[model samples]
Target chain A: MKEIMAIVRMKKTGATKKALVATGVAGFTAVKVIGRGKLVTDTDELEKCREKLLALGLDEVSDAGDTETLVTSFLDGSRFFPRRLFTILAHDEDVPRIIEAITTANRTDYGIGDGTIFVLPVADAVRVRTGEAGEAAIW
Target chain B: MLLIRAIVRPEKKDEVLAGLSEAGFNAATMVDVVGRGKQKGIKIGGMVYDEIPKILILVVIPDGEKEKVVKVILSTARSRNEGAFGDGKIFVSPVEEAYTISKNALGL
Candidate 1:
């Protein structure tokens, strides 16, 4: 068994769910998560701010005194963004299909925040109701 | 790396998290879930509450740190000194790889 986890944009959740259901996924767990990517600085945005500072006659942005201020102003304050985390368990054969469905649904024109898919190994699964185990329980 | 998933009593969530943090394993994901264990559910005065609320805590760490992490959870998540049913259960699985979404770098 495989545990397929996808961290996607909050707005794309509906589309992702529909796509999963369409692919015949029996069930999945969705959690509201606040997370941020590792990129703390966006070079393009920084460059834009640099230009704005130069326009304002503040050429000391490169100096240590104003560096902190410049960086702080560029930051929106909240480092973490809201996201939806979907955890899906499936047979090995279904892993590829599920991943494809999620990607197709969450992909956007910008292509950066579509989200990430992680495949992990699941040693076993059990159905509490019937005491079923392994593949029997998953189906 | 390994992913340690512990389905613990909702009330004990804070203790477990604190234990982990103090032990230097601060990164974890928590999800509220409902399920039953070996004892099944609980029986009340006249009704059977099969679905019990639980907090599933997920922590990914280096494989060598599994023992330390699990020990922390076990000590803190117990209901009582002697421990009892419904305290919770833990599952450790292998994580092939991890990626940081923003950095687009491999391995966490």
Candidate 2:
């Protein structure tokens, strides 16, 4: 089985969800992730965003997984940056088209921001929701 | 077979996967990666940030499903705010072969 992972901006979550659901591989695991990238915001606006998100109870932990991306001109210089994690387990055969869909979804909707994606082999898989193991669970 | 590499805003990962899975390309692999585009990373004050968090999803597909997956990623990742920035990027390449190491088998 393969595990497809993606990280995107918080604002794009809704569209991302629609894209995934459309593909039959809907099961996924997600997390709120923080990042420090090249945002195009001025000092004042940056501080304002930092203050607002902090007030909203968003605490960004240091990224230990190296899962963050940086784009200088995203948003034509908008400096606010927030990210999310999306992971799925699937069979090896299903990878290519799913990736294509994901790219299409991300590109058309990203608007002003840029991000990155990579795929790695899944050594194993188990359904956390139902405890089903191996390929059966992933599929 | 073809390999599709989509560097999208990390948030779009789930929706994109859900769409591809539903389309019959049910399996894919993912990795956590960091990189920047011509935009050249974000600049705050004197410091320039070059690295961003991105999820890399790797999937091998028979020729048939390529278009479907591409379409799904495109439509979903688009935004109503056309003036904003940081939407993400995608790349596709051909695969000469595929195999499941554990199964010790060739071809999907």
> Largest TM-score belongs to which candidate?
1
| Model 1 spans > 4 angstroms off | A9-82, A88-117, A122-139
lDDT (10s digit) by residue, model 1, range B1-108: 888989999899888877887787755666778898888788888888878999887777877998999999999999879998888899988886565443344555
Q: What TM-score does chain A reach in every model?
A: 0.74, 0.60
What does the lDDT read for residue A73 in candidate 2?
A: 23
Q: In candidate 1, list every pair of residues with a backbone clash.
A: none
DockQ scores of all models, one per candidate = 0.17, 0.02
Residues B36-94 of candidate 2 have per-residue lDDT tens digits of 77889989899988897877666666778778888877776655536235667767776
